[model samples]
Target: MPSFAQILIALGAAGGALAAPFANTTAAAVTTEQRSAAQTFTGDITYYQPGLGACGETSSDSETVVALSPAQYDGNCGKTITITKDGKTATAKVVDKCPSCASGAIDVSSTVFQSLADMSVGRTQVSWSFN
Candidate 1:
């Protein structure tokens, strides 16, 4: 199975967005989604280095932050979401945009990643909704 970075590169050319599901899924914290009526989304969750993001926030890797796909970014920019993985749950803030992520996928920081699984795991599947 390809690592999250590998799949990112492989799918980057396929319209600049992820279209397939990961064979190995884990959980995550940060993501972009419109908050409304408790909408829940489940998909691949991965981690990314944080910095000055789309939301104009500078976050460190140790921060509980996340990114959403481009399609979901603009509207949900400063929202908070609750992420769940393997019965472990945490809340994270939407701070950046995951250019390569799919609609339901979330890209998060190291702190949030570790809250769900070991960073070595790289990728997982998580369910998240606005908080």
Candidate 2:
């Protein structure tokens, strides 16, 4: 037969082992909650040239172009879009669609382009994500 002290120690060890799984599960839940709170997703796209009278004389650098599926062009004009260029991010509404876009470039306004990246040069590398 085991002594009383030995029996108590064995019970304590078994209890801890059983609690391990629950502790791990709680930790995982906390991590998932934090990730959901900090969720920020971004989409990648290209930049294209703007059309005449697009943004009312905004410079090339401050312009952006988003491809529309014909119907989405005029209907979703005021939809908000968050654009991240270089390291800066700017939020703007979808105003116009570039009819001359190459394949996957979405056109934006000159002010937005300038706020997000340097438009002085021809084109800039940008990553666009919406939330």
Query: What's the lDDT for all of these models?
Result: 0.83, 0.55
List where candidate 2 sits over 4 angstroms from the true fold: 1-75
For model 1, residues 14-58, the per-residue Cα lDDT tens digits are 744443333222221222112342688888899989999989989
Tens-digit per-residue lDDT, 45-121, candidate 2: 43454454333433344444343323334444545556666667777555556665543345565666567656665
TM agreement with the true structure for every prediction: 0.70, 0.42
Clashes of each: 5, 13
* lDDT score for residue 52 of model 2: 41
How many clashing residue pairs, candidate 1?
Answer: 5
